[model samples]
Target: MLCLRSRTQDAWLQRAIGATRDILVDHAHCERKAATQALMLLGRFPDVTALVEPLLDLAREELEHFELVLALLQRRGWTMESLAPSGYQAQLHALCRKAMPGKLVDLLLVAALIEARSCERFKLLAEHHPDAELRDAFGGLLAAEARHHAVFVRLAGRFDDAEAVRVRLDDLASAEVAILESMPPLSRIHA
Candidate 1:
C-alpha cells in the first residue's frame, strides 16, 4: 500500500458530488498544474535518470487529462473560468525543503503526497457519489493517480536517504491535513 499519511474527509466528498462543475474546473487546473510541475522538474533535473522519462510521461498524461476535463466542462455548458488560488497547494508547497538534492527529494515527496490525496479523494467519489457517470469517471482515474503516486515515491529513493524522505513526507502530510482542516468545506477537487 502507498504510505501517504493523510486522507480526505467524508464531508468533502459529499460537497464535491454536488458541485461537479466547480470540481471539474478545478480538476482541469490541477491537471494543467501537474503537467507544468512535471515539465519544471524535467528542466531542473534533466539528467536524473529516475525523473527524466517518468516526469516526461507524467507531463504528457497530465496535459491530456487537462484537455479531457476541459472538454467535459464544455460539454456541460460550463466555461472554463479564471483559476483560483489553492490554499491547499500553497500550504504544502511552503513545507518544501530549500537545499540541493534534498530539495529534489522534497519535491518528489510532495508530488507523491498530492497524487495519493487525489487518488484517495477520487476513490471516495467513486464509492459514494450519487451520479453513476461521475462515479465511473472518477473510478477510471483512480489507477492512474495511484500509479503517479507510486512513481514519485519510487523516485524519491534516488536521494541519499529514502528514510529521510519518508520522515519529511510524514511531516508535510500532517501539515497538509492541518491545512485542509482550515479550508472551507466546499465542493472542490482539492478541498
Candidate 2:
C-alpha cells in the first residue's frame, strides 16, 4: 500500500507551476542523487549479495531519469543549478538508526519511504499539473517508483526477519508522515 500523505495545500502546486525552472533543477539533482545513493549502498554492502543486482538496476534507472529530467530542463532553456539542501530528506535520515543491528532494516525502510513518497508526488503531479509534457512524464515514472519501493522492502526481508522489518517499516512510515506534515512547504520536488 502507498503510505505517503498527499500535499494537501494548494500552495505547493501553485509554487511548482510558477517556478518550473527551479523545480526542474531540483528534480534533476534529485534523480542524480538517487542514483548515487543506490550505488553507494551497493558499495557499502558488498557482502549482502542479494542487494547487488537490484541496486545496480535502480542506479541505472535513476541515472536514466536524471538524463530525462535534464533534457526536459534544457528544452525549457533551464540549466542545472547547485542543489539546495533538502530538509525533508535530512529529517528522514536523522530518523534512521545506525546499523548496530537494525541498520539494514532502517536503511531499507528509508529507501522504501522515499520511493513511496516520490511515487505519490509523481501521481499527484501527473493528475494535477497543467503542463502536458510534465504530466505525462510524471505519469510514466509511477510504475518505476512503485517497483523501486517494492525492491527496497523485499531486499529488507532478505537482510532480516520479514515480520520484524514490516513492523519497523510501519513505524518509520508514521515518522515520515510526521516529518512531511511538519516541514515547511517548498517548490522543490519531494519537499
Candidate 3:
C-alpha cells in the first residue's frame, strides 16, 4: 500500500498541487505549439524519413496530452486563460542558427533541454501534489517527458556532427540559464 506523507508534508503538497494545475494548463499550450513546429520541420526535412517518423509520433502524443489536459481543466471547471509566453522557448529558438546541419542540431538540443526541464518539473509536481489523482497524472507525464528528452538526444546524435552538437548544446545551456534567470516568478509554467 502507498503511504501518504505526513500532515506537514501534505500542507506543502496542497501548495504544489495548485502550482501543478497551473503548469498543466500552460504545458497544454506548449505541447500544441511544439506539435505544430515539429510538423513544419517535417515539411522542410523531407529527405530524412528515419528522423521524421519519430517526430511525427511525438507530435501525435503531444496532441493527445494536450487533449488530456483540456479534459482535466474542463472537469475542474477551469476555463483556459491566456498566459504570458515563456522566455525559455523564445531563447531556445533564438539559438537556432540559420545554417544547414547547425539548424537541425540546435533544434534537437533545444527540444531535449525543454523536454528534460518539463520532466523535472513534472517530477517535482508529482512528489508534491496533495491530491492523489494529480500526483499520478504528473508522475505519468514525468516519465513520458523523460522519454521524449532521450529521443531528442538520440536524434540529435544521428543528424549532427558530435563536436558541433556538443558546442551548441553548451551554448544553448548557457542561454537557457540566462533566460530562466531573467524571467519573473513564472507561476509553475507561464510567466
Candidate 4:
C-alpha cells in the first residue's frame, strides 16, 4: 500500500510538471503576441510614443522569456507542442471595441486582467508543485507576471474617466470568470 501511494504521488507530480511546462509555453506565446499587438497599436496612435516605448521594452523582455522557456524545455528533453485555443484570451479579445479610445482602453484592461491571472496561477503552482526546479521557475514567473500586470494598470490609468475604466474592468472580470467556469475538463486553468 505504501508503494502504491508513493507511485501515485510520483505520477501526480509528473503530470503537474507537464502541465506547468505547457503553461510556460503558452505564456511565451502570449508575450510575443502582446509585443506585436503593442507595436501595431503604437504605430496607429503615433501621439502615444511615450506610452509605446515601455510596451516595446516589455515585448523584448517577453521574447527573451520565450527563449528561456524553450531552453528549459530542450534541457528537459521535452518537445513543445501546439496549444489549443484558450477561451480566456478569446473572451478578452471579444471585449475590444473597433473604435480608437475605446479599443485602447479595453485592450489595456484585458491585458491587465490576463497578467493578474497569470501571476496568481504562477504563485499557486510554485507553492503546490513537487519539483524544486519547476517551483523556482514558477516563483520567478510570478514576479514577472505581477510586474506585467502593474504595467498594464499604469497604462490603463493614463486614459481619461477613471469610473468608465473601472466599469469596463468589472465587465471584463465577469466575462473572464464565466469563460473559466464554462471551459471543458481539458482546460488546465481550471486546475
The stretch of ten residues in a row with the least summed lDDT in candidate 4 is 1-10
The collision pairs in model 3 are none
Task: Give the Å error, residue 137, model 2.
Answer: 0.8
lDDT of 1 at 17: 77
The parts of candidate 2 lying over 4 Å away from their true place are: 5-9
- Provide TM-scores for the models: 0.93, 0.93, 0.84, 0.81
Better of 3 and 4 by TM-score: 3
Question: Residue 72 deviation, candidate 2, in Å?
Answer: 0.2
* Candidate 2 minimal-lDDT segment of 10 residues: 1-10
Model 4 misplaced regions, further than 4 Å: 1-18, 187-191
In candidate 3, residue 148 scores what lDDT? 80
lDDT of 2 by residue, 86-124 (tens): 687888878877864478768877888888988877787
lDDT of 1 by residue, 83-109 (tens): 668678877777777897888888888
Number of the candidate with higher lDDT, 2 or 4: 2
Q: What is the C-alpha local distance difference test score of candidate 3?
A: 0.70
Instruction: Report the lDDT tens digits of candidate 4 across residue range 1-191.
Output: 00000111233334545676675566556666666766776777778866777788777877776777677677777766787676667776887887877888888778877767666666766887777876787787777768877787678768748788777777877777666656654424322
lDDT of each: 0.82, 0.83, 0.70, 0.67
Q: What is the C-alpha RMSD, rounded to one decimal, of candidate 2?
A: 1.6
Residue pairs with backbone overlap in model 1: none
Rank by lDDT, highest first.
2, 1, 3, 4
